[model samples]
Target: MKKPFIFIISVLGVILESCYYDNEVYLYGNGSGAVCDTATVTYSATIAPIMASNCNSCHTASSGNGVITSDYNNLKTIVNNGKLLKSVNWTAGAIQMPLGGQKLPTCTLAKINKWVDNGALNN
Candidate 1:
């Protein structure tokens, strides 16, 4: 009686936990995002979405390396790292963000590169 209920509860808990874990990126690096400038660095609306959608998972300031992609400061590091516009953007090496999201599109990549080349202004 009690044992049966306990077993059912445990199984249900496991299933629910698994279902709660979501790694899917709802939005990809769509350069169509709105623009928001922060003065020093141009926080390309499109760029933040991609980072938020992909890198923020493990690179948040509170996480391991405290690498927060919440803004352009951290994002510039990406360009300086030589992987900003590359297929695999990361500091040490290829990180392939969003864990398993689709590869960033060329237009999106080019947008990021252009924004950086244009002084990375926050406009």
Candidate 2:
């Protein structure tokens, strides 16, 4: 009886231990190990792609609802007015961006903030 009880407990312990969860890379993604290079955030490359993928779908040349995201000069207006970051970051009093989608990824946000902080250059 004692031997049987010990065996069952050992088996349960092994099963429970295998169920442990501490996978940061799996939960948070490989971004934990990968580097996010914000040092070269640029409009033509970084910002354009982000906006094209997330914003331009709705905020285009003629259908932006007064926000023309397809044009760089018009986009600069929003950047200078502080609406870009506020909307993307979901700040109070600012419209939440991407309309109904989940917020942008952390690395993407960092690159955006870096660009904006650097005066939101047209580069």
List residue ranges in candidate 1 displaced over 4 A.
Answer: 1-44, 64-66, 87-93
Cα TM-score of candidate 1: 0.48
C-alpha local distance difference test of each model: 0.59, 0.83
Q: After superposition, how far is residue 15 of candidate 2 from its true place, in Å?
A: 45
Q: Residue 37 in model 1: shift from native, Å?
A: 18
Per-model C-alpha RMSD? 16.5, 10.1
**What is the Cα-based lDDT of residue 38 in candidate 2?**
76
As a TM-score, model 2 comes out at 0.72
lDDT for residue 76 in candidate 2, whole number 0-100: 94
How do the residues 70-114 of candidate 2 rate in per-residue lDDT, one tens digit apiece?
768999999988888998988998888888898888778888888
